[model samples]
Target: MSFGALSDIRIVDLTQMLAGPYGTMMLADHGAEVIKVESPTGDMTRPNGPWHTDDAQKTHGGYFQSVNRNKKSIVLDLKSTDGRDALLALVRDADAITENFRVGVMEKLGLSYETLRQVNPKLVYGTLRGFGDPRTGHSPYAEWPAFDVVAQAMGGIMGITGPGPEHPTKVGPGIGDIVPGMMLAFGVLAAIHHARRTGTGQFVDVSMLDAVLAVCERAVYQHDITGTVPAPLGNGHPFMCPFGQFPAKDGHVTIAAPHQSFFERLCDLIDVPALKDDKRFASPELRGRNREVLEELLAAATSCFTKAELMQRLGGQIPFGPVMQMDEIAEDPHFAARDMIVPVEQPGSARATRIAGVPVKLSETPGGIHSRGPYLGEHTKEILRRAGFTDSHIDRLQAALPA
Candidate 1:
């Protein structure tokens, strides 16, 4: 298996849903052998839809396939003694294990970090929770069940993410889960690095609320430094004028002419050369203070050109972008040139399904989408055999697991 950078590592993934699975996939993308351990019932997303098939009758749908690529699946009924023993055996040689179960679920199952450490002292235990694992500290909401919306609301990202203060909105994607997942991947790598060096491993956790807050830190710092509770200012930035979306003849465009030189150049391109030196908008601070007036002036000029026309005039001279929908992005030459999208062989679909490709390019040892997510318990017997269980033992285990 020529997995990329983490090919030497093995991850026992007990995670379900978006957060934990997303993090495990990051490792899998870089060549780690990720064994996704599911309950007899399997990951909840296996039945989720938006299927790519014409009939939309696929066993697994887009949601599961999107984040779960490059991994294998195995089923273990952890309620049974045989299952627990099997996992302990697998853990004894594994590099890491990750889960998104609530505060005390693992402890109740007797598979807590303390117990797993006894099996594999170098096992890095990573978790994502709405609050956090109790091992770190008991959040008052430790036992409270949460999802992406809860984290976004509590974490301050939603507080400043909408058209205005009265209209705060959740972000378009599940950033609460996704960002924490990304951080957990980094945390696992760090823990594994230290464990390999010192022959010890530790529990690593990320609170979804904490991760969202960290990513939306500008709001926090703004509140602390200036006592100005940051609120959404439509599509523009707080510190820079002429740095947001503006309407064009056909669609929208964005310009980031924050610098004095860039502002002068933008003015020349727009045929409003006098505004570049006007006292009311000559400097960034002045422009910011009078952004309302400047935007009205800029919007009037920009509304004359189509998006493509603006791109032609201002694309290279200053920071500029066309507001691209997915259909446009699918045909964009830049994305194709960079390989930002690729195809994976999905089972139910007649042909391969396209998913976003790896953006973190490493020229010499680049990571990639290696394979599609496995079928439910697709490698159960194979994995048990690898764990030193004989065919007879595997037969017993499979019988105990749900078919």
Candidate 2:
């Protein structure tokens, strides 16, 4: 039972950077055999820093390591016939293949879905495009280069994500890339389920803009609920009072005491019990209506206490948590208890590094980070060998890569 959910599955990951890699990583974490298909240069983030190594040969940095655990690397010079043949051979037995290129990059490689289906009709082909693939719906900006910022700006998140309209801010995390990656992962799984039953695989796609909009779906309904469009509310919730970030003496804390009981509990904790039954702030609706005044009252009390002091009084009494820095999270017992902060082997670095572990825990058949990601083309020979390539064929493919 411990083999895991997707232990029987395999993926040919022809993707680089965040969006595609993150999707494949999700599958890989589920015990799928994820074969990372890379060009000779390897994934772009492999060399970019927050680095742990000084050696050029083993320069895979935090960005690549974070998303690429539990995967194998096989570099291919797709421009070469030998390399292309090697990839096609691998695809013939793979359950799915994923790529995050522009509209026609797969076609340019002569590895379009039509071509691959001939080799393996049961293959689930997934594409994570900037605007989406032409098969789904071609965009006027189909060929435009895009990144996390572009998706956030155009996908409606930036419009309602800051202290004020004039000072809109990008979210700290790369939700544009990561959210699309998450959607693509689910898309791949759904397509695989269908393909397994019907023996006819289909194309699955998710555009960055589409993913961002889906994640920000609340904004759409907000406009529908009221005639007015949504706007930024600083650290406050649109419809809930005492449900946002508040200043502590040391840092900030987020307290979500929006319910009657929770609100009463929070009011007592903050020494504002008089407001618990006050007519103007009695119910959730009234509190929401007078959110500015309510928040100011809470802020006045919260600002007087340190983060630790607030936690001592409010922890577990209401939906309350202090804004934790990385160091605090690292030292936190809860994360350790849940096995969230995991130790990972860093290849060139002398010591291992701690990384965020898989959060979705299962009672049985749990999957995990099997190993650190491989060095550039580290598994090229091994993967080709598994594909039934002869030693001479493998040698030629290796030689095809530019030195």
Candidate 3:
């Protein structure tokens, strides 16, 4: 059953793909009734899959299922008049609506924020874009289409990521899109609260480029204060010594003991107590200045032990953790205890598969993944009935769906 802080809130989600859908997913996870309005052909990610070996139908893929759990789906071809009317009807009572279409797409479809606000003045309209909507601020790149890579490149993340400035690298995950989606979720909730208080709502806009830049906040201040541009330092920090990944015999482990007490303790645990008193590594500043020498020494010491051995010796003594891969993470008991790894039924297959679980824990009204994402148009009839559409009207809406 849907039960959480937002159980009474309903969102008409016109978003698709990663960024927009992820934001709505956060709300839906917290017990918001998110009605995902899709085209008749369904979301583009519906076909994106490394399908389960036992599932034959493949109605929805892992990408779609990951961010779309606990939501209802209804097909609506916004290009058609009937479909537009149906969406309008749904928005009339919705607490909020979200979209990630490029600028002018909604305006062309006659469902722009301006138009929707007239239908429901208090409706919270949240949008995620590559740049930003012109209604808020005009970006020269507003018309330009963008995905994860573009945002990462243009938004300063790629500039300060990877090994060095000459070899900038895209982050492994799609933080370009994902971070903006998270920001959009926060913006939506903030706007919803404002609407409830003042009986008015304003357009909420999150630019992918802006969001990625926000993630690289430290770089901005560093450049401004030091008058020097920041570049990637491989896995090490610019100011901290012995704070990055160090090689173990079998794998790697990250160690952070920049403070004197911790550093002394770490040296003693690693059987290098004399190194802590060495003139070159006596202070944090000295250690940072002589990082290369200290790193070499620490690596030589740590390389004598395997990751498991290092963990056994220093796991809780200092800020230390093994650089674990997915296989290790999957088997880690901490994930099981915290419910960070969850298993859900693989539709059309008897066996269950795992997905990442909710990280935001609410002690009173907890949110959870109780079900998988819906099939295309899985709740079309039920949703339309709740929206006050007659059966005949629902049929007409269905007829208007894209072939």
Write down the lDDT that model 1 would get.
0.90
Ranking by TM-score: 3, 1, 2
TM for candidate 1 is: 0.98
What TM-score against the true fold does each predicted structure earn?
0.98, 0.97, 0.98
Return the clash pairs for model 3, or none.
none
Q: Report the C-alpha displacement of residue 130, candidate 1, in angstroms.
A: 0.6
lDDT of 3 by residue, 30-147 (tens): 9999999999889999988878888898886789889999899999989988889989999999999999998999999999999999999999999999999988899999999999
Candidate 1 weakest lDDT stretch, 10 residues: 52-61
Give the poorly placed runs of model 1, Cα more than 4 Å off. 55-57
User: Could you give candidate 2's per-residue lDDT for residues 1-403 as a string of tens digits?
Assistant: 2256899999999989999999999898889989999888889998876765553445667788889988989988887787788889999999999999888877898999999989999999999988998888988988987899999998989888999878777999999899999999999999999999999998998999999988888999988888788888898999999799999998999999999999998888888789888898989999999999989889998999999999999998999899999999999999999988887888777767677888878778787887887788888788889999988988877876888
Candidate 1 contains a number of clashing pairs equal to 1
Error of 1 at 365 (Å): 1.1
Query: Of the candidates shown, which would achieve the greatest lDDT relative to the real structure?
Result: 3
Worst 10 residues of 2 by lDDT: 51-60
Q: In order, what is each prediction's RMSD in angstroms?
A: 1.2, 1.6, 0.9
Local distance difference test, per candidate? 0.90, 0.88, 0.92
